[model samples]
Target: MIGMAMRGEADIAIGPITRTAARLNVVDFLTPFQEEGIGFVMKKIDSPLLEQMFHVFRPISLVCWVAVVVSTVLTGIILTILAKLSPSAEHKEASLSRNLWIALSSILGQEDCPRPTFHQGYIILGFWWIFITLIMALYASSLAAFLTVPLPNAPLRNLEELASQTHYKPLVTQGTNLFHLFKSAKGGLHKRIWEMMSDMPKITVMDEAFSLVETGKYAFISDSSELRFELRNKCDELEIAQDSFLLTQLSFVVQKNFPFKDAFDHQ
Candidate 1:
């Protein structure tokens, strides 16, 4: 790590470092830029309503809805025809038909008359059917749009990475050294990659130095700091590499309150 630092090629790095070894010989690790806190947060439990909605026979609910829609459409058509053809005389016809049956009691005791028109009833029912159908369509379209949009996973995997790009992807907790480190060093930082890191395993930023080594299958370490503001929730997940780096000091990039001529000063 010290040999690489001498060349000044590693533009960006975030990790723990003391003024020792090859770094002390020539390269500058700066003051501690950030400290790392590490731990794992398990996945959230699924909602009960959502879980039950996907259970077997759920399609039955959809089928019932479709059936109701079909029935309403048919009823609307029937009502439309009835409303266009019904007459005010239909009520009188029904009354006369009943009286005729009474007069024919000695004979067949029945009367012939057209059925009463239900035009007004049909018109009202049809209007309601159209309203319900429109609502259903709007709901379906909204659901489709929600399903189509893509949601991004959190960036920045662990504290070391958090130390470097933490300004962009790191999450911090109150009173954490990592939080203070980021607060100070965020103004200006450097970066670089190494050949050894290419084969390093992946690690989640659970705590200090978990990402220092690598597993056969994975090659990243994860970390986060200053969680309350926004980053902790955003960079909830991340992957980090196992390459060790020269830790830089957390220096403040004073923009508004630049006491010195340079923005990068001891914050």
Candidate 2:
């Protein structure tokens, strides 16, 4: 409609179009009738506590978890190789799988692992014991702290938090102003959000965005007023994020330098 208006095919483009500096270059906007901002809409969490039960692994970060696993495997391989080379009569031959199991069990504080007889074996076992004990202590303390403390079940508060988590796939309609905002973004939260949405099929309609949000695994970003009006019937199931972004005025688009612009502004 904006192109049509610019080509002299239409005098004006109607509806709740956003007024932007870029759009003003090719067309003119009427006196903005309304002001609004972008918002995120998602299903409300009904049982935050139950949702948290599955997040037991949150006590350790992904990097730390990967480091622990890699170190444990490397320790097991070293122990197995040392066992093969040790000439002591007391050093029993063990398979790589057995040593791996021993390494895993020892980290868990199990008592069945046999004591090593050779000096190198003893040294390796000693260091491994100390390392595993420290890791266990840290994990135990953190888990205990998490269990005993009361934490707020805060809803998705802002874009930074939303972009950082994998729980919800944030979505925006294709070709809309909000979509273009992220698509053209070079860095930071907007870029992150665009990358996330790129994985799913392009969403073309607002209804599809609402359907995806209903499943609780996706969030839709759109005009706050539109979301409120559309989701009015499903207040209990869906909610808009408390915060908004990309605040702008909404107005109708008219041909560039339309003669009636002054008269339209008067009303």
Candidate 3:
């Protein structure tokens, strides 16, 4: 379209062509109709059944659980030793199994759990109760969060995340402004991404790229609004990632000396 307009085959080249410095030298752009930035579309993935089943334990780590178990056993052992060392005859007949049962029941908030027999035992039990209460409170809060928070639509939320991952290939429409943006990148994330996609197959059409995205293998980058418009009907299977970059105005192209520039800009 740009070439046609430049050659006088068309008076105006229309659509959401990005206004860039290089293009400006060859053709003039009407006042931008819209301003948008780059974004990506990818397929939505559901949490696996295995992940859903084990979500109950997501609140706490394995190491923390192990530590809790070790603490409970140690508390039980200390309580049994204290009972045997007590001066009172009534408190002297302590067993490890009984102490362990008491510790477990107390930690579980059991009302009928046996109490410590001596002063030292009571002090230790009090501290243990405090520790167990804290652990339980933390676990409850974390479990609530795990249950209520929805999973992300896609794992790659933004450009940085997409750049960091290796499994998903980034794609752009060939010969587009976005394509040029990466091709001309000299340094930073854009340059890195361009390098990464150097050997990957090129995508020439948005629909073709989106189809690949649906397979969970490719990410298509384009103007944010355009990506949204294209995915409006397919939202159940595809979604725009939470990224906006390469900000630019979109306008129609006209010949460099086109006479009606003001008339078009006003609309």
Candidate 4:
């Protein structure tokens, strides 16, 4: 459409055609009717079922879990060994099973287990309590964050992030101004993304690009209004990014010295 207007083959082209400095050389655009920016259309991200189920345990590292288990066993063994060495009948009655129960219960924040009676038992139990207190505090502090925080499906929020990721394929219409916008952009995120897209297959149609976006692997960069319209009417799974890199004012394209330029601008 822009080509037709530029070549003077069409008197006027009515649509959301961006008016850039380069285009102004060949064609005149009426006062902008719509203002928008170039943004990506992506698929809505869904949290995984497995992640949701295990969210409670995600706060602590795997090494921490192993450490906790090892500490529990060691504390129980220490208690049992100390009890055997004690001469008192009450201390000697602390069997391996009883010591293990005490250790497990203390670690689990339970108070039902009997307290250690011997002096050595007291020292070992005191150290075990300190360790348990620290571990409990760490787990409690991180647990709330893991359980309540919502993880976004697409972690890429801006062009730089989108460009950095290989899993996300950002696309643009083959012949549109957006294609040229990136193609001519110099030495920045725009050029980087343009180079990335250059190696991949070209997307000629918005609908085709949108279909790929529905799969959640591809991102389509295009006019915000058009993308939003399609998102509302066709694909519910698609979403628009909050940040737009290229701001453009859209107007009807008319050939230079066209008779209706004045009338169109006045209206």
lDDT per model vs. reference = 0.37, 0.83, 0.86, 0.82
Best by lDDT: 3
Predicted candidate 3 versus true structure: per-residue lDDT over 170-232, tens digit per residue: 988889887888899999999888987887677788777888888888888888998889887
* lDDT value, residue 82 of candidate 2: 87
Query: Tens digit of lDDT per residue, candidate 2, span 5-104?
Result: 7887888888889987778899999999999988888888776776667678777777988988998899778877888888872435446776787778
lDDT of 2 at 184: 91
What stretches of model 3 exceed 4 Å from their correct place? 44-48, 87-93, 117-120, 141-153, 157-161, 186-188, 233-239
Candidate 2 regions exceeding 4 Å error are: 48-154
The positional error of residue 92 in candidate 3, measured at the CA in angstroms, is 11
**Residue clash pairs of candidate 2:** none
Q: Could you tell me every candidate's TM-score relative to the true structure? A: 0.29, 0.59, 0.81, 0.75
Superposed by TM-score, candidate 1 places the C-alpha of residue 103 at a distance from the truth, in angstroms, of 39
- Best TM-score goes to which candidate? 3
lDDT of 4 by residue, 118-210 (tens): 788888888899999999899998987766785555557788888998887888888888888789988888889988886656778778898
Q: What is the C-alpha RMSD of each candidate to the true structure, in Å?
A: 17.2, 11.0, 3.2, 3.8
The TM-score between candidate 1 and the true structure equals 0.29
lDDT of 1 by residue, 38-82 (tens): 322222223388665764333236765676556555544544444
List candidate 1 stretches off by more than 4 Å.
Answer: 1-45, 49-117, 150-267
Q: What is the lDDT of residue 55 in candidate 2?
A: 70
Judged by whole-model lDDT over C-alpha atoms, candidate 4 comes out at 0.82
